[model samples]
Target: MTTIRMVGFDADDTLWRSEDYFAAAQSTFESIVGAYVGDDARTTERLYAIEKANLAVFGYGVKGMALSMVEAAIEITESRISSSDLQRIVQMAKEMLRHPVDLLPGVREAVEQVAADYPVVLVTKGDLFHQEAKVRDSGLSHLFRRIEIVSEKDVPTYRRLLEEFAIPPEGFVMVGNSLRSDIAPVLELGGWGVHVPYHLTWEHERQADIPADAARRLRSLTHADELPGALRAIAAG
Candidate 1:
């Protein structure tokens, strides 16, 4: 195995607080709409369905999520949802956009340590403006050599990233929370992938279990600070 010379980080849950906001927003949305239907479960399921359906049109972001909430509310109530409640859903989206960027535990120390030794890149996917805002506000912006806010995370995207950075896959390492978006692609490209499990993964980012052989190319850490040691072990192997 080649020594990894470049490290890539995933921005959302991997670096800072993200999904929790969505989860919170969902709760708020349900409370606002729950009065009409009185069934939080149905509304929740409907919201997820609307989000999935709108992904192609809205892509991924808080704005799209707001739209989905409105659509779900209208659908659940048969368009009987009040205009004021609709406005509340819009307000929820605004709140999410203005939400603070809270970095996960040890993100700063680990990122700084890796930046001192190798080039670090932030490879993240989502609405361009929101993702950029999170990175800019996260206070870890200066630690990365470059930032790539992509629409998708797949094999070709990683290949292009490797080429753009002028690094071979064998010499690159990706640390992220989602196996589907962050880990699997880099592993398929023959790079080292370090999985750091997150508590609340977005449904769309979930995938089947990785093959045994591929899973062996990676290590799982419970926290961000453990990343430096994991990378060192990979290099040592």
Candidate 2:
């Protein structure tokens, strides 16, 4: 097998704290909505339903979720929610957007180790502006040869990226947390994938369906500290 010529990294969760904040916001949203509904257990499910449906219209990110939350709050409460609560939902999103980018343990060392031997690209998704801002704030942007803030991380998107990098699927390994966005797509394209899980994940990303036959191309790690060694193993194969 060809050695890895380019390494693709996902920014959110893999490099820094992300989902947990969103989870916190979601909890707050539920509490806000709960004051009206009184422990309606399906509140989050309803919110997730709206978010899933709105994915195409709003795309992924805090802004999208904000819109969905507002919509869900209005619909879930039958428009009985107060304007103040609605504003609070909006404020939650702003807080998330302004949330500091906290890099995970050893993330910088891992990226630097890999970049020293291979061209590394940061392929991440979210609202373009927010994603760009987070990447800039993360202070690790200088290590990447290229930064791609994409709308989605699916098969076609990865295919296009590999083509732009002039590397074949067999010679690239995608590293990140989301099984659906980061690992599944790359594995589907005959590339190697490493899943370094975060403590929390969005419900949508948790639904990743990697091909059963691609098991040999997939690796899972508990932390970023294991990344360089995993890449070396993939290369040796």
- Candidate RMSDs in Å, in order, are 1.4, 0.9
Off by over 4 Å in 1: none
Q: Taking the tens digit of each residue's C-alpha lDDT, what string does model 1 give over 1-29?
A: 45788999998899998999998999898
lDDT on C-alpha atoms for all candidate structures: 0.89, 0.93
Worst 10 residues of 2 by lDDT: 228-237
Q: In model 2, what is the error at residue 236, expressed in angstroms?
A: 1.6
The residue-by-residue lDDT of candidate 2 on 48-98, one tens digit each, is 999999999999999999999999999999899999999999998998999
Clashing pairs in 2: none
Error of 2 at 223 (Å): 1.0
Q: What's the lDDT for candidate 2?
A: 0.93
Model 2 residue runs over 4 Å out of place are: none
